[model samples]
Target: MLIQKSGHIIVNNSTNIYEEGSIFIYWEGFIYGFNQQSGKKTIREFFKNLQIHGFCSAISKLHGSFVLVLANEEKQEILVASDASGQMPIYKNQDMISSSLIELTERTDLNKEDLSLDKAVEFVLTGFQFGPKVLFDAIEQIPPSKIVSVKKRNFFLINRDKEDDPFLRTVKHDSISEYLNQWEILANAIRKEKVSIDLTGGTDSRILVAILNHLGCSFETAISGQPTHPDVIISSEIAKHLNSHEHFTSIHKVDEDTLISDLYEIAKNSKGINDFVGMHRLFQLHKERAKRGISLALGGGAGELYKDAKQWRCALLSCNSKNRLVDKLVNTGFVGWGMGSQTPDQLFQTEIREKSANYKKDTKKFLKDIFPEYHKCDVFRLADEIFYKYIIAAPRGFSPLMFPHYSPLLDAAFVHYGINLPKHLRFGHQFYREIIAVLDTKQEIASLPTTRLGMTLLPKRIIPEVLTSVFLNLQKRKTTISLNDPNLYSLLRKRLKRSNILKELVGIGLLNPKIAIDNIPNKNLGRLVSLWLFLRILDKRKN
Candidate 1:
């Protein structure tokens, strides 16, 4: 990594005291830093132990998705910690550790002049980059279940064995009552706070509504994006059936003219690889929350960690045969190996293809490191990587900046409960429905079909011929609201021509000028444009 910035570790600053009492200890995410109970644990008692035991200890013992920062005046040092799932990332520059990766931009020099080879390959194939590696190489991301310390000119890590608690070495199943007990405990915390939910027709939020209702809490709900979306219609009905106030449902339409400029700006700042059109509109909803004084909202985040789609990804990876892996990838139209397909592997250039192919070994190794217990369960492990990378990591970037949201499933108690529980019940949301059924609250969540599958929670695969016809019809609708809008491709082509990235890639022999722009679609165009924007935005050091 290039260390070109002059940032001294301040050992002590008497002036750093009391701004908010002239001191600022910046930490984000929901923290259960205290463990007060009949154990008679005081918040001070908790901190005293935390200062001695290290940062991640609180999370292991208390369990929630949070980032904790502990600054010790006595030690003249700072400890930064992220939760077990690494839900909130902490970025480190030569000088400081921060929650935001944008901090790295202030440095004039970077460790890498181009994208990391492994990341480039992975992003092109998978639509997102690997963890602990941001869009920039100079800025390093501190992985989850870690405590990092910066003292004077010294930097180091404080690793605890308890960080591995969520990955529980042995597989065991917790009962339905246990899961509900955990949910009930979490729900009780904000029962008096008038909780607000982005209630959807989906199981995650619906289950949350059921729990909050059973607790007799004051709760309201909202939905955003298309008014006609099944989630919107279903969620509105759910709120009515529960007899709770409906907060709002955003029906704001986006302007196509904005995609060429403002959309790129949003994508760049978001620093996400896979998020396309509707996901980016989370920015607009942020403003809505602030106007409504909705301080805390709830959503179902890690629900997919055990869903059928997740299991499917696992089952494919667990094939343990390269030919089978390649065959599955080809059949699903996911990895276009071109085994007689019209434009097999034509999406990315040959060099990119080869680079991606080579990284599969490294990628498999990476997954193993994250999940060492998954000898026969690589599927669950791989699904977890997807959940963590896209579901938890990408979206949480919007929060601590936009609005704060939580999922009960993300809590450490719930995570441990589900992971240890029978695998079959967890992902299909069969267990989720069981909890609601037991709650004796509204039956809507249990009886209603999810907006995601349109048919219900567990959807049956339609015949390929019928599916193809339906997809083609949907594909023809041509919604301009997409980041993948064909018109945006023209804009991206122009943007590429003006940018120095392609020339730089050519200089590095990473680009083949002849085939760089061949057979690209709106999604591919969007990814390329976003990558180009990342290079520019990071290069220009734009905040």
Candidate 2:
């Protein structure tokens, strides 16, 4: 890994880069090639293919969550591309490009004056910035599946001749089997590698078990959560059934001081975009996985593309106006995570409140222009994009950076097959259930209950098990550590009292510091603390 601290670059062995002659390739994340090729060779061939065929033709040949930077000294040209899944984020400006947003902004001397009021509003409301927008005005995210050509010295963007993208070629299939068949092929490629699966009680990870079992591939399973949590319990049951080696990491309770320390650590390390709270679990999980001598870990990221398309479908009905619809779409799962007790009028000073009025309008224009169509397919496409942007690409998706992580379900060609499936087949969970049934031939895996629905996928077995599970679970006390608890709120309030970042935001019209810290709703305390921590980091960088 390459660490940039106080404006100096530090190199480490974990940095995944290959250099031969004047050509250079830097990448992080897995590429599951069918023949189990080396990363160096695969990336080299990809660039060679790009030089011959074009961006679309070259990119479609590669699959996995990755960010690739290819520099050619001979041509004085560099190309940057992110995975189609958008799990890896690439931030850039005219002069600098970096995988880390904080590093980019710091190097470019971006400060409070560079902040975008609209994005600030969005961040406060939804706990994330959507599409290509980040917190800084000068820095923008390179959207997924895009190839940007830059000149060597200045890194000025160059226009490329339009090439036919074989990857985006839409093939309307007559049967669902076509999609399933492609899914298996992608799964088969990953099975050849020594794989570690993050098994959960959720349908997504469970589906992975069924598919890998069908492939007759051996894999170790791991789960992170409370010992009594459904995720840990259910994953254990499935692993026991398969007689697979399983690892469990308990999410133990922490002291208030430790919680505060972790939040600050996440804020400093998250590169200035993600909400730092609620990420400790995954951070601990990945930290442990790194020590297990695992070569590569398979995650259930982007599983929503098949298992639950309805989350996106429901956003369309959220409101009548275009901007409202877009807001609903981008902020679906994140709505209540923000300052719910305060409206824009109460939350911001006059200038920022006025600027925030155009937030919905401007955001709708920006994101809709990115995923333009208003049809069912377009809705799902935008939702999937947003998922990658806010969830996968955010600090929450830090699994890849922690350990060798990849999700074959997010394979380029297979996702193309999934999103292109008929609306009826993709919307409900039935499409995924059918795939699970086909893969779990003996019905042993599919018959197991999922953490999401707390019941089996099999119709006949669902009702009875759901009733019993609900009754039994209702009697148990919840053991998971919640950051939203009163102690956290009290600690954060004390910290905010000593910090001027909130006052600075209020002075700049981004927040209303006059609102008593006590008046802030408990649900929103984490968001406030997260924002304050990020602002503190920025303030230090400015110094």
What's the lDDT for all of these models?
Answer: 0.53, 0.62
Scored by lDDT, model 1 comes in at 0.53
Off by over 4 Å in 1: 1-25, 33-56, 62-65, 93-95, 169-173, 191-196, 264-278, 312-353, 357-362, 365-396, 440-442, 452-519
For lDDT, the strongest prediction is 2
The TM-score obtained by model 1 is 0.74
lDDT of 2 at 20: 71
In angstroms, how far off is 488's CA in candidate 1?
7.7
Cα lDDT of model 2 overall?
Answer: 0.62
What is the per-residue lDDT of model 2 for residues 167-225, given as tens digits with 9 covering 90 to 100? 34556663557765665555556554566788888777887777776667767888766
Candidate 1 lDDT by residue in tens digits, 288-391? 77687765667777666544443345344656643343334344433321112222234445666666444554544554465444455445554444344333
Regions of model 2 farther than 4 Å from truth: 1-15, 44-56, 152-167, 174-196, 216-218, 312-345, 354-362, 365-367, 375-396, 459-509, 539-543
